[model samples]
Target: MPTQPATAALFPGQGCSLEGVKPLVQRECPDLYELCLCLLDADPFERSGDSTRYTQPAIFLASIARWRGLVRRGVRAGAFAGHSLGELSALTAAGVFSEPDGLRLVALRGSLMAQADAGGDGTMMALLKGDMGQARVLAERFGVTVANDNSAGQTVLSGSGEALAASALAAREAGLRAVQLDVTGAFHSPAMRPAVEPFRRAVANVELGVASAPVFSGLTAEPFSNLAVELSEALCAPVRWRETTLALARLGVERFLDIGPDAVLAGLSRRNVPERAVVRAEELDVTA
Candidate 1:
């Protein structure tokens, strides 16, 4: 018998917009659109700029809407893992909480992250073609944290501008490519310590359930059962995306379907697990 194709659904993190998905959400999920309207006070695509306060919830709604569409078409995922803010979207899609409640939690998370960012001048930069161990050494020396371990040679370092600049220069001296990100906060690092406790309370207040599908956590890079414990620590921990993808692949995930606006995770998965297929959910032919 032919091997069954195992798939994992992926959601995009912050900095990705809902512009590409707004129409779909409005057309296919009127309830979700109404909730977004109440939460954001406008249609998701109405706000074009990337504000952390709005970006998280907007992306979460859009990602979930896309996943709902896939489910309607009988697409079944063996596992799911989202990148950063995408994790909330993943949880919502996996039946952990109602959409409205999940949106509220995401809003709180974004606000707390923004507040934590106000404590200092912090940011993130992607270091390309660098060894992870070497990058960790340089990051530690400059007090920056390796925020996102996306792939083998791709790692996102986060901290103050001066710290990032120093690390970038050192990385250049070591023949690595360093590019600054457009985000305002140093997310997934110790810089978000201020937000951790409050977000923990918010998550604790929520009614969570066992995941309908395996949810590969960014914190543990394994199955997640306790959102309060795992996600609270995620506020001050690096996103172990590379390990998550490897774990998914090891569990027979042959395809990763990007259900958010951008194909960012699909692109990242290409670098991490080139042997598997990566596709955007929107690209699927639902009409068939």
Candidate 2:
């Protein structure tokens, strides 16, 4: 028999919202629209623009839809992974939870994070280039925290706006590149602690199950069985995306399928695993 395609499915996080994708989802998946409507009826999207609850559900639907869409077209995946919020979607796709349950949990997560953000006054910044150790040191010096280790040189810093500003200035003075993020709160940092308690409580009600495939944990940079607890830890923990991607690469995963509305993970996978083949769910139909 012909060799099965070496495929790994990846999911994107917050920055995955691309132009025109949401509209496409609304048009193509009527059930998805209805589900979104139901979610709106409960807490409503307008109520939580920056809520982790809202964003998480939104991302999960987008990703799971794309995954189902791809499966409909005969595509197959051998492994699965997601970045930050995308990990929950990955877990669901890996058979950890049903679609409906995952969506509900994501919404709750968004709500908790949003409420936490309302209370904590903080900001996020992306630093490009320079030493990771140096970046961590700088963040500590300012009492800020490293929110994400996205790649070899790309990282996100989180803390009070003043502290973020101070870090940015320091980085600039040191000739390091940094840019402020357009985010409401300091996600993936200690600043998100307020979101943690509610999230833990919300997750306590969830019925989590074992995943079918290897599910990497953003908090541990390793796979774990107790996915619910691991996912809860991820809320206030920085995403070690670079390490996760590198681990996948080490496993000889040459092809990546980003099952989400946008190509955020596809792009990052390309950057992180340059030698591998990275394709987005949206781009599949166009391919021969």
- Top of the candidates by TM-score: 1
lDDT per residue for candidate 1 within 100-145, as digits (tens), equals 7888888788879888888577889999998689878988799889
lDDT of 2 by residue, 1-288 (tens): 777567888887876564444554555555765776687564333333555555566666667767777777877777778887888788788887777777777777776766777866777898888667878989889999888888776888988898989999999988889898766777887766776766666667778776766877777777755665777778788898888888877876778888866666777788888898888776887122
Query: Backbone clashes in each candidate structure, one number apiece?
Result: 0, 5
Question: Clashes in model 2: which pairs?
Answer: 52-110, 53-109, 53-110, 53-111, 54-110
What TM-score does candidate 2 reach?
0.89
Candidate 2 stretches with Cα past 4 Å from truth are 42-53, 286-288
In order of appearance, the predictions have TM-scores of 0.92, 0.89
Error of 2 at 268 (Å): 2.2
Highest-scoring model, lDDT: 1
